[model samples]
Target: MTDYVAKALEVDIDDAVRRVREISEQEAMNQAISVVGAGPAPGGAEWEAEQGTDTPAARQTAWQLVRLRIELATGIDPFGTVLGLRRMGTTWATIAAAAGVSRQAAHDRWGKQVLGVLDAYGTGELGGPVADDEADLRRGMAR
Candidate 1:
């Protein structure tokens, strides 16, 4: 679970718990992304037909797979950041600021939900290609 983000933000598991529970500004990020406006858009835009006649429906189908891939892969990012920040000692107030809501609202959206993901990660329940060191994924993010 240790990564650049975790290291730089000091969001290892212990820190996540501490940061998430308190409102202290020891080292929290000033802004946070709201779940409502923060999600990645489902994409099927660049899919090229690999077989058959490249019809609109065929194109649609090709892109459907892309959308599915994106959804399955990066769905954890928003909360992962929250979990990391929270674990790192970032305050809920900081998180809520980014979410544009009260601290409780951010907690309600991501608190318990993050726990489930944290559990999965803690037990290695989920496995796949996790980004290791590359940065700047704005190209893939929602517009």
Candidate 2:
């Protein structure tokens, strides 16, 4: 396929995936809101009748869902960005500087795993092996 066509297809797929994520996150937020909005805590008689067994689980799940929604909504995929930067030859020291951590600390914390992901993604554009133009694009984006 032509490069333009391939790029368009990739963009379409990315958009579809993003939409699915948004919908799932919205549903999760709605569920969490419902759980939190449920009326006041049960009194002795009501508590005995209703059984508190599900309350803790529900609240925990709801909160967890809410956290996930926040993460997704924030557009902060540390893993992806870190791996991408590493693949683009951003040294650990540079990354650490940007992140406000020591170089050794950055390597110790993320070097192996992030590099591994970067290797898997092949340091490229369109989520494939890195190419010269892709590197140029990354540099452009950085600027």
TM-score, every prediction:
0.29, 0.32
State each candidate's clash count: 9, 3
lDDT of 2 by residue, 1-143 (tens): 46997777666577788887677656655664675664346676655655647764445444543443343456534444455555544555555665566766666666557646655665533344322223433454467
For 1-143, candidate 1 gives per-residue lDDT tens digits of: 65887676764587666665343222121211221122223353433332334454333333332332232243423554565544444455556665567766766677657546645657733233232211222222323
- Candidate with the greatest TM-score versus the true structure: 2
lDDT of 2: 0.53
- Those runs of model 1 whose alpha carbons end farther than 4 Å from true positions after fitting are 1-77, 117-143
Clashing pairs in 2: 123-130, 124-129, 124-130
The TM-score of predicted model 2 comes to 0.32
lDDT agreement with native, every candidate: 0.43, 0.53
